[model samples]
Target: MTRFGFRYRARRRVLAAGVLAAAVLAAAGCGGASGSASSSDGTVVLRVPDPGNSGVLARGKKDGSLAKALSAVNTKVAWTGSTGPFAPAAQQINAGQLDFSQGSITSAIAALGQKPGFKLFAQIAPDKAGEGILVRKDSPISTVRDLIGRKVAVNKGGTAEYLLLKALEKEGVKPDQVKRVYLNPAETAPVFNSGQVDAWAVWAAYSVPEISKGKARFLVNGDQVGSQNYSIWAVRTRFAEEHPKVVQAFYEYLRERGLQQIKDPAAFINVFTEAGPQAFNGAARELTISNLRQGAAAAPIGAAQLADFDGVARFFADLKVTPAKVDVKPHVLSLAGSGA
Candidate 1:
């Protein structure tokens, strides 16, 4: 062939090879993309009750802390806040409508015993001596001893119930010795204010409102019960298995941000107010900072924390809340050593 003809033929062959290679890479890319999309099909949804009470989670979402952290792992988070108490949130998790929920250790333990569909995933916040037993401002009941034979309202299957039981035990009182009235904080608050119930076992956030209204006085705090407890985050076992990475990322996000908040009280208080309504702004912010400091000083999740859980489980078992004692090791997920 002539020189020009030979050059043209060489160019045609090179162009053809390039097109073939492009086709192969395109096919491989398509297959890999399809596999990845299929592998990550669903978004993880975390249900938290009352944005007011969920400081780290709520502030993380509002300030993009959760979103930024989860984005690094290519996971999506859908945070839904509950309007009522934790029972409704627990029900949602039981019904499989939620992947996980934030609740008190007592509530999660009770749910695990009653509903076998869920499992405790992690301990979120250690009890900070915050919750209390409250009585009407001018009532004759000055001490827990005065509550004997009195109608004391407590939300059964809730943190309040556990606190009340422990408090009574510490005071050498039997559970059945007092008239226990089961009422949620929302329902019991009004009645307690109207002198309907002699006392109310409630968290500090709820108790603050009643106290501010001159309707209630703090009788005892959680620290007086002789047990150090914590709040927990739990998920359905199936859901956790399916999304282990997502679960790890969620836990890490919370821990990092939670610890950061624990370090800076003023910053946390500011972010907290921005997270939700200012319903309990002043008191809530101050109390949360105080509680965070306490949790920070406590032992980080390790064998000691596990032992603490064992004590908690025994407490519940003794109260007949669970059929028998449970080994908390199998249920607790420790992100600290997981290297996630």
Candidate 2:
């Protein structure tokens, strides 16, 4: 089918899917109201999910930064693997499988609309360098427009998809022209390496490893498109509302740790790279440092940030990634002392 024909058909199907999803979510109540309570042993464990690659928690845990902060509050921190798009992790958070989760702002927004129980409370890296559509070093796909009728891997509903869509928009490629293969960060590399996918739209840890190996080259990067990328930490609303102290202390810890990294980029990069994601070695080191240097220091998520999130939500809605416009403010956790 022609690109125009495919887009026309996909649009109709997407609209139907969006409506059905909305109706089902409405009936299902968008989850929440079931987050796990404090354990019987009187221990408060906060389960946090990461994108399985950023190594943010790893650095903190290794350096005892997290231990010091959580210990002071008598809270136990558990690191759980939450690779890929992170929509699953968000759903896990809604189902009470997780106390909190963090990832691409796109997934958080999508989850907010799909599942209502969670709240976005903190902003993490807005780093955009090294994030882009990567193609085999010798591949014929030389530019964004070269991807038409090609296969590109992206984690649907996550930052990968958002960047891919935005890139296509900028390049004037119809959405249906490129086939988007959905895969998690862990899964994407193998598939991309084996020539299973023509290209990959990914960021930071995911894209850096491959680029360092000289296995692929950027057809275009996130910065080339514009630096709108951001990751956020979110907790279950009930958790925030009920255990304000824990939430406040948690974000405070994150903000402090973030500042520490910014204050000493060289030391931070050395620690993060050597502590053995091991993928960040070789040529990847320079890229990693560049991204860290460009990364946003963790900070409170507030009005201007909320407005940016809301704008992204509208972008998703127009593209039918979400059922309709979502006013993101309702789901933002605004605790009194939380610095959220």
Candidate 3:
């Protein structure tokens, strides 16, 4: 053959080899590095969010415990962390892009208002100190009543907004009394620090750093204002129905690990904070450890938890935070206990 002809034949052979390899992988049911798929070997790949790099699932992924536990039930995890607001996470779950994740009950209720995309499998008790409104330490706003007429940043339709609403109600302040600046967490952080917003209704992720640095203080914590919020784990609705065992196994593992972490926050600090990109340092790290010690832990979904979820849904609906009313009972799966 001529040199050009020989080169053409070599290229064809290489292309054929690549095609064969791809077919082999497809036949094995490999769903790439991050997604939900089942292999011929009876292993199920489940896609889940990383939970801001400080949640149970993130820590579970850092160590081998999560995988090892799931292996017994023939399930694998794919940590496909989400970016941006809760709406995106809800959209992903609705579109079947994610298999499992954890978020506040407020977000879950908002998600259910649109469609039956996911189901609550387990719950974490109220982290009273994990969320609240924050103001500069030297700010004049010393009481919830003082928030009237001041600008406060909150992620609309989220825990922060919920907290702010409840706080205002507690203080007899009308919804329109305070200026609600609808800003996301990232936006609220810089604005709050720069004194553009009088106060920011936020979660521990943003508040802890500022508090630890002595630049901010909590105007009102969830506990102080009787927050009924709960942290919940959700599985894709169809996925949960299709793979109940997998969901059960993962929930049990999370519950076990979460309990352990609650008992000894230091033991899992490395995995929760040091292993992820959003790791905390210095005063923030110390403050995180302290908070975790007193924070909530994973628990099996039950009647009481469902009742609280219903209350949250009702509250959001009544306040027009959610589009319409949602009944959370139908959207939850009581795997380990009675949740009716």
Candidate 4:
């Protein structure tokens, strides 16, 4: 099969099976409680996965800002921890297991590509600064080109997969030329540290802790591979269609509170400390904040973001990451000027 053809087929098979599994779960009543709120009822249960290592979510949880802001609209959020990523969350939401959850633009794209039933609610902060490829501290690999023929651990069908594909292409390394291991973050890190893999393309929230322990060295940041993208808040399209006002209010709270956090780096970092120990030290935190500010200054959901999404979709298409050439624009939700 051609490179794209092979990857696309693989993705389709896996995602198709995943959708079937979700369908069974839905029929079996194995999902979360249905989160339905009327304008008259005063609670909005915002179901989020356990913010395990998500400093942004953890920080918001710590200061009570995330809850307080939502409560302003007479909505209270309830977080639900699950092992599933965006696709399964979409399934759960469809199965009436969730109201809303945190997801990246790529996650939403992949999930929607599989089922097309979720609606992007709002563009959260562009966490572009968070994803990267890291090598062990003592590893001889110094550059992306050096990784050729080496074993690399990546979460296949994830943001890291796309990031690594772009990095490898930029370095003129063919996909099959390297040894790629498919692993989730939990599995990838321990094995990466134990020398089972030469490197890892991991999300920043996970990568930071490894770097802090001197377990790895960053080879390339995701921002260098693509335009600054977002971690979007999305819900089932059915839910959104029935409750436009609730959806609007939720978006408004996230945009307003997120912007406030972005404006004050020091305070943001302080709040993040509650998430965990320092992975990005003060210097790193400052750099991250600067990048977030740049993303915030751009239109919340601008043409630039759409362009980036297109570029990413094309990259995945060329790499044969999905079964079909997908259009990412329609899935994105732009809550412009509703930062109340």
> Which candidate should be chosen as best, given TM-score against the real structure?
3
For model 1, residues 56-133, the per-residue Cα lDDT tens digits are 655665678677887776655543443234455555555544556655666666665654556665564445355778
Distance (Å) between predicted and true CA of 243, model 2? Answer: 1.1
The digit string of per-residue lDDT tens for model 3 on 135-189 reads 9999999999999889999877877899999899888899899999998576566
TM-score each candidate: 0.76, 0.81, 0.85, 0.76
Please, what is the whole-model Cα lDDT of each candidate in the order they appear? 0.58, 0.65, 0.70, 0.59
lDDT string for model 4 (38-113, tens) is: 3335454545443432234455677786677667656665555432446666766666656676556666666667
| Global lDDT of model 1 | 0.58
Least well predicted 10-residue stretch by lDDT in candidate 1: 1-10
Q: Each candidate's root-mean-square deviation in Å? A: 18.2, 9.3, 12.5, 7.8
- The order of the candidates by lDDT, greatest first, is 3, 2, 4, 1
Q: Model 4 clash tally?
A: 3
Clashes of 1: 0
Q: What's the distance in Å from true for residue 210, model 3?
A: 1.0
lDDT of 2 by residue, 147-185 (tens): 998899987777788889989999888899999998765
Candidate 3 accuracy as lDDT: 0.70
Deviation in angstroms for 96 in model 2? 1.4
Flag clash pairs in model 4: 4-320, 44-76, 130-204
